[model samples]
Target: MFNDGSHGFSAQVSTSGFNRRRFLGGGAAAAAAAVVGPALLAACGSNAAPGSAPAAAPADDGAPATGILRVSNWPLYIADGFVAEFQKASGLTVDYREDYNDDEEWFSKTREPLSRHQSIGCDLVIPSETIAARLHRLGWLNDIRESRWPNKKNLQPGLLNANIDPGRKFTAPYMSGMVGIAYNRAATGRDITKIDDLWDPAFKGKVSMLSDVQDSLGMVMLSQGNSPETPTSETVQKAADVVREQQEAGQIRRFTGNDYASDLAAGNIAVAQAYSGDIVQLQKDNPDLEFIIPESGGTLTMQSMVIPYTAENQKAAEAWIDYVYDRPNYAKLVVFTRYIPVLTDMTDDLNKLDPSAAANPLINPPQSTLDRVKQWPALSDEQTKEFASTYAAITGG
Candidate 1:
């Protein structure tokens, strides 16, 4: 079930053994006990194989109301149990489906189809930078022009200038974060604060990666000196060496999906390679679980929503994309999903919704700290395959 890197670094993807049928059958009242914990259940939804989702339901009523807007995303991407409200406001029933567990799945389904400017069968989709750029190149995007969504101007400054969709022109930032450490301070009996910390011998068998190649190894490259902005294949190769060596030394305990939240909350791991937003929700119950942007440098990353060429409900899709940026609503999502708000106004909102933002370096990192972070370059198809293989070899997946 795992890809052993006999030839080169590879990725091993499999089921997490969490019961999805039981969760769905349990319904809302039993929702709190659904899976892992709030940190994960609220952040990651259940997974299924990649395939076409059912035809979107018709908008209610005889007259043509808003059409069903099919949106594909990682599990629990939208606010939990708020579909009814979204349907009411827009008159569009969201045929929301969770077919993708990670960006790689998104790329597999959307990259080629979108590159050819063909329909990928979703109205709204979220993708990491590499695929977002490819979508822009293929002209698969319908413009989220400033005239249409003025609130975009308020997105956080760091994301405002990302290279993948520079100026945020092609894709509106859905949620952006760095791949770094989420540690159990109480269990580790140490303050974890750097990318280099993942390699510490004392923490051997207590670490898990993102179950991704880029973010996993890209963070290592950032620590060694490289990013999408200054992509040096040589540096990347060296970074791969770090993973290979670390794995050989038994530093990595497992390669995990969002499931790490359960392990960290249960004190099964002292530290984990984590996304920024997920940790915010994790801290709600386990207040001591903290995230850090390693001093050795970490990747600056963003996920975005793009209106695809095949959208069935373009207007509804555009409306929903803009809704993700509304100050009050977005603040609520930040609390539920643990993603940092792109709007500057969110700082005050975070103070009110989750005051830890004032002291949480991961969400409100100082200007100087953000300056040190690097991002991975959008790869060409040949390069993506090569780099993916390089990363696979390192981790032995």
Candidate 2:
């Protein structure tokens, strides 16, 4: 799955030839089945409420630097040559492992050790925002702000103080993807601009939505002028009701994972809820395919880089984060991952690297699109179970 080159190394990491953004978006159904019930609740057993002040981070030991940093991140998320470049620049050896395939699996593996205030053998890990929030609440993550990370100022203005990591005390965004609409223009014979277009009678039985509860239902809620960032039981139920109506009337063809890309490319379906990164790759093969963040709105999900509380190489980990935040280095990462860069200033540097990627709206989204996409709220375990159960009923899981 990996190709080694003279200058650097690249990996065809995923079996489906996509990255973790697509993997999580497509496998969301199975993830929900595996993580949304008792396992999730057990992991979120902290008494602190969401948005409350997180418990004080563990005190930093004055131990000498280990000079070795270990990171566990999702597969194929970084640029080729980055490891070697960082090592050369900082004189640190990085033991980078792409083993963070699933959030729940990682959480399950580390819970026992972390709950005992022990190391899980890695200095840093990257997990989706929700999981990072859970780790913060559990006090399992170190406060990155305490590290010597000057480039933290380069973060996009909107990401500065997210609800999950207010002031980014615990985590920083690594990469992100938007959940939006993708359509085959040859099949639709027109443009698809809004979420409501998917429900139009003209495209009945030729429309497919993602099996991911937050993504599919969030779009429906956006169509009705509701924001998923502040979802309530009433709004969630309303969205679920619309989904049920569409399914029963045959207005919706099916609920899908990553397989929707194949169907859409082959003209088996006209429209599908898709991740932005997936569309970037799909459009290379099918010129007729187009992706858009709906005029009404869409959802944006992010994976974050965090330091474990028990890390032995906190200084080295901080240096690594700072190294990637440099504009030129971050541009290379954006090009390699084909995901949204978390920096406010990237287009110029990205254009210098790859002009084509700099122009792709999916990769370098304009301000208008950025204003319209919202991140889903950090739902409590009970809230998650309720929403997932309702969505399962509609999707007939």
Candidate 3:
């Protein structure tokens, strides 16, 4: 699965028969749009615009359960066989489609219909954190907390009370990834373990940072002993100042999306702010490449499943969420996703399924690393602009 445009990394395995670069293309394009997409939507006075009055929550009409459920997710996001098993166990047919390729594109296509309180033809959709927050603010999603999903307790304790969904009323995390330093050990000639290491004079002009404001700035904030989970405009500006200083001093070679992976692999750059899963994939070709959650900390990004307010099969959608939250079932998913699993107590189950995956730190990070990872808070539109404008001026985006 390609995450929110800002973090474009392929989660698909090679055997899945999908072209990684092809998926990267859509993701890259979306990343470019993400820089300005939200502002543009607000300017156009779109009903789904961020900060607009949230649409009224849909009332439960005591409607009968729809026998069929529709889910739209990023391509190659889910493991096979589980869907078949889910159908057999729940007695509900699933119309699952992997058409959610880009966040900006999906929003553009569904906004008009969703604004009119009409279904986007999906009972469930998987969107990255930023997009999920936008939908929640627009009141376009149903509150799953009202459903009978007992497995909601399986959610990682750290993930509870997300800034976007205070009680996870609207969304459930599908999978997660960390944004941190990825380095070519041969180029660095040593291990890169902390966020400030990117500023070392030895690696000047051989380092890259993500172009996404939240990601790049989040990591920088951590290095300053600040937490991104509760950022203020002042802290964001402080972080952006660091980035500008690094860029002007020739410490940062460039700002990039997932393309940083290629540069790191070919020895064009020694270190980069990179996605965890991308490094997992790159390690296949270059064992020297290593991804680390900076000792200071790193940002966590989640692709979450949500039911649109107008979905027709609410009951079936809740069933699917429950089914996947089951530890044994989620372990099967981690083998395919190769990203961090969202459920707690998953290590033993995952080890039983794919011992290699369970052993990979990128897939199942140690407790110390998890302790340092934090999610960027849900920024209001004004707060977003304050952060984006300053960061954009420095990056020339």
TM-score of each model, in listed order:
0.70, 0.89, 0.88
Model 1: residues >4 Å from true position, as ranges? 1-74, 80-121, 258-268, 281-288, 351-369
Compared with the true structure, all predictions reach lDDT values of: 0.62, 0.77, 0.78
User: In candidate 2, what are the lDDT values of residues 28-129, reduced to their tens digit?
Assistant: 354455444335444655333334454444455655345889989887777889899988888888899988887667777777677656779899898887
Question: Which run of 10 residues does model 3 get worst, by summed lDDT?
Answer: 17-26
Error of 3 at 68 (Å): 1.0
Using TM-score, give the best candidate's number: 2
Give the poorly placed runs of model 3, Cα more than 4 Å off: 1-11, 14-66
- Candidate 1's displacement at residue 363, Å, is 4.6
Candidate 1 residue-wise lDDT, 34-109, digit = tens: 1212123223331211221212223333333377888876555566556676787777788888764544335544
Which residue pairs collide in model 2, if any?
A: none
**Candidate 2, overall lDDT?**
0.77
Winner of 1 and 3 under lDDT: 3
Q: Once model 1 is optimally superposed onto the true structure by TM-score, how far is the C-alpha of residue 209 displaced, in angstroms?
A: 3.9
